[model samples]
Target chain A: MTDEGPLTPRVTGTVRIVGAGLLGASVGHALRARGADVVLEDASPSQLRLAIDYGAGRAATADDAPTLIVVAVPPDVVADVVERELRAFPDAVVTDVASVKLEPLRELVERGVNLTHYIGSHPLAGRERGGAISARADLFIGRPWVVCRDGKTPASDLALVEALALDLGATPIEMTPEDHDRSVALVSHVPQLVASLLAGQFADAPDGSLRLAGQGVRDTTRIAASAPELWVQILAANAAPVVDILDALSQDLAAVADALRAPEAVGARREVADTIRRGNEGVERLPGKHGQNRRFASLVVMVDDTAGQLGRLFGDLGALAVNVEDFRLEHSPGAPFGLAEIAVAPAVLRDAITGLEERGWKIASTTND
Target chain B: MTDEGPLTPRVTGTVRIVGAGLLGASVGHALRARGADVVLEDASPSQLRLAIDYGAGRAATADDAPTLIVVAVPPDVVADVVERELRAFPDAVVTDVASVKLEPLRELVERGVNLTHYIGSHPLAGRERGGAISARADLFIGRPWVVCRDGKTPASDLALVEALALDLGATPIEMTPEDHDRSVALVSHVPQLVASLLAGQFADAPDGSLRLAGQGVRDTTRIAASAPELWVQILAANAAPVVDILDALSQDLAAVADALRAPEAVGARREVADTIRRGNEGVERLPGKHGQNRRFASLVVMVDDTAGQLGRLFGDLGALAVNVEDFRLEHSPGAPFGLAEIAVAPAVLRDAITGLEERGWKIASTTND
Candidate 1:
């Protein structure tokens, strides 16, 4: 089925979602929104009922044969579910949305499952909470959805999975299961561990120290609030790769500690400075908005904490026809004012500033300075 | 001198700023905006002239004997400047805005310089760049301006420093030099090191791994982009406390690495889960906006990439009379749409959602589900 809209991707055939958790329910929602027929299944009857009630999809029946089967279960049971779905739906191309790919693929391979029709995919989008109630139709929109396929997999099967990702407004990236696991370990898993451990240090902090916490600490430790139970499964499933990255990070942390301890020694300060400088280079390597390498110039505009101040600023920008590439609002603790940092294209920076100034909004700094 | 405005703090004497860098220039601008007679001084002639041209203050003269002196110089030279200022203007209540407090106090004590008129303050406000050109008059507004006092400091001197902070629209927080140093070490200094080291890991990551980097990694390493040269000085001056925190962090990292390496071992998974769980509790201890433990409910509103979409949303919010306590905009890597997470008082969440939905905006999820 295809929906008639520029925003909707043309996806055909019936899609079966075999879990009613966050990822599965979200996939079903997105697909159903685009007029694709979706079938929902879950081991828990309540979850299945909730997904259906939430309009993700209708209950699946034995007579229904789907064109594609998406297995969205936990990592520990991904292999088992994928195997069962493949055996049950021999005519359907099967895919699983498990965070870690290599282990499950290995397990399926060891179990002698025919994997020609199976592909492993991971949509790198999630919220803090799970379950069907929290699922949204746009959960995967604009996110990176990794599709893992071996050389033996048929092109038609790969195309079907890619179409699904595209229809859901995600970018489909092709990678081997091994590469996918390693990439996530470096980018996601290791960072989560670092944030958690860093935040863990706060437990022993002196009484008043936390009261002094600022945006720096808040941002650094934000992900530490993630569910421990979910992370345990993710970390354990991708233990080998995650552990390797953690080992490297530990060595670096040790070096930083040594350097800080004896900063007066020759070369110690340089070592500390070098690590921080390398970090600068590393962060710059990450792509900017819209997955592009282009950078935008930022200007800070001052606003009062009063309700309509931000609205007025944005309205002024709209009148000036300045497109804000990005925006961040910074409010100091106990302060009744805020600074809105607006990111705009370099070409429009001067015009945007002059326009805002003409509108009586104070420009703090055209450059971070 | 007093400005005829309710927002202006009542101060009736001349204020002199010694350094024409970001902090120094900002102080001059704020005091001048409040109609205080201000004199600016700087080692760099260009910076001083820039501050003067920016309407921060006039150039300092030998005849200018200000009642209050703010020494806003680099950490390495803060003590020297503070001592010189006290000697130059014996009657002036002297204060220095340096990140580290204990070192400067110690240096003055060792030199036998009486600090009866001197108070150390550090405004917990800064941007990535530093210069007179980047200064903002309202930089310290609503931020914590920590005033470090000792027994020898007279009540009048303490009151003068606090008055300066208040006049500049900052909240004055009093703490002993030792306590202030320790508090900042826990909240700011150590988080900086952790972020830098964590970002350092990305330097050698396999190509394309960073393309998968999400907000979690971005925030965890955001502070790593700060100037290494500046951090080197801050970290060095506060070496002892920062090193202590780093040592503890190192031990934790080692334990996490060990746990991840053998996740299937007895209690290994539990250990991992425990560390992350502790992180949750630690982050929970941090006060939210307004420096209160109260939590705000968040709802995500979807907006298209078209110009004026955000403006329309904000305008709608204003029309509905909803007070947004905090806001965060999340855009996908390659998506043309963005999610605006608006934090509102819990009492108004239902009304806000209903109002926005009535206005035709798509509600992604109310609870980050």
Candidate 2:
């Protein structure tokens, strides 16, 4: 919807979103914005009415025959819903937005459902909370939408899903179901487990030590606050791939623990060093803002803990023509000021420093000056 | 230095800092700003000269008699340096800013050295990099500086260390050396190892999967980019406590992995749910900004990817008299705009949304509306 030139959505015919949760309502809102007709359905009548009232779409009717069917249910019931939709709308191109792709696809295939009308798709976008009330039309904008396909997947069926992604302002990525599951297992599922396991260590921590918690542990365990109800289903459905990654991680953890236990022994220190070094390399592989793999030069400035101080600081940056690549605000307990870490291009680091300093800002640190 | 009520420093006499690294140079700068005489020393000549050149302090001289000694060295050499500093300045009170305290304290006690004038203290403050060049005078401001003591410690000697902490604008926390080590092991050391061990799993991950990484994994693995040399030493020094936590974590991880592997088994799903639920509870224990254990309401607004857009948005908030508690900017791949998630007090959430919407900002989502 942010794009004005394209009033015509790529998706055509009547689009149906089944399940009025965050993703379903969001999809309905997006398709509706694109001048496409959308019908909504949910197992819960109250949820369906809520999405409809939010202007996402209208309630589905018995005569409604959708050209595209988006199955937006939980992972546990994805295959069952997809099967029902495929049978109900025999000619419609059916796709799903479940986090894990393979298990549902395999289950549908096992149920001997018709293969011509089904494709698996997932949009790598979400909010902390779920429900129709939290839906946003622009949620998928700029996010990746993976379309899972195989040799038997018809081009026309795949095209409908890709068109949905495009109309919703998402980048369409073509991947096999196996690849999708494996990739998410590595990037998403296992990391959730790791964060949870790490946060769980805080159970026995005394108040004195917990008081010393810094930004490092906070960032490392931030995802541990996710809802367990949703995670249990996601992890259970992708158990094979998740287990593979966790088993490997458990071994590495045990090795590091053993090395730390006898650090003065031959190669013990080396083993510990190797693990952290490998981590440094692994983290380096992640792309930065806007899908670029380049690093940003970071500088920290001290700001008084008062209202409108950040506004004035950012206003000065804008007036100085400095583009902030990324920003984070760090506050110490009982400190009268906060440290605002601004990331910018390496070439503009000097200008940002000179301009902010001239504007009466205190520069705490700059990286690789 | 940000506080200008008085020029006289609480810390008295010629304070000698024996390491010219980040902590040492920062301590020197802060004390110098407070009009305290400081003498500097380092094993490396260039490092010592660099600290002096950076306006930290004058180099140590043969006749330099210090009333206080701060041993700011690495963890492995902490005891050795502390022993020498205590012996060299027999009349002066000595302290070291080592990350781990129990091992060095035990080693010094085992050496049968006089412990009356020595204290183990650590300021929980640091930058990602080390050395004099990256040091800042306000490093310890608003941070917790732990002072380790036992029954034999004198009140006068403890007062000197506490005054030093007050001079640097850090809160003085009293704890036993055993408690300090165990606390950091739970909060800092274990989290570091967990990040490293989890990031190490990316060795065999395909690039496609890595590209699918979202903010969840990015935050969870952020600290994995830390320098390995420092962590190896910290982990090694705090081995016993760290191993205890890791052992417990290893057991929990093994249980979750086993549960996921056979999710259909009795109570298997419950096991997985319990781990994440425990994480939820543990993360909830961390203190929020300014040491308050409170939650903030979050709302997301769409901002066009342009210079000064953020400035404009924040300016609007400031003009509307809305104070932002926390903010994060998330951009999607190939998206023309970014989502700005602003966290504010729940009472002011309605005002923020209404004001932003009236100013032509697109409201993407709101919490618990």
TM-score of each: 0.96, 0.98
Q: On residues B63-128, what C-alpha lDDT tens digit does candidate 1 reach at each position?
A: 987889999999999999999999999999999999999999899989998788999999888888
* lDDT to native, each model: 0.86, 0.88
Which candidate number maximizes TM-score?
2
> How well docked is model 2, in DockQ terms?
0.73
In model 2 chain B, the worst 10-residue window by lDDT is B1-10
Model 2 residue runs over 4 Å out of place are: A1-4, B1-4
Model 2 chain A scores worst on lDDT over the 10 consecutive residues at A1-10
State each candidate's chain A TM-score.
0.96, 0.98
The runs of at least 3 residues in candidate 1 whose Cα sits more than 4 Å from the true structure, single-residue gaps closed, are: A1-12, B1-9
Backbone clashes in model 2, listed as residue pairs: none
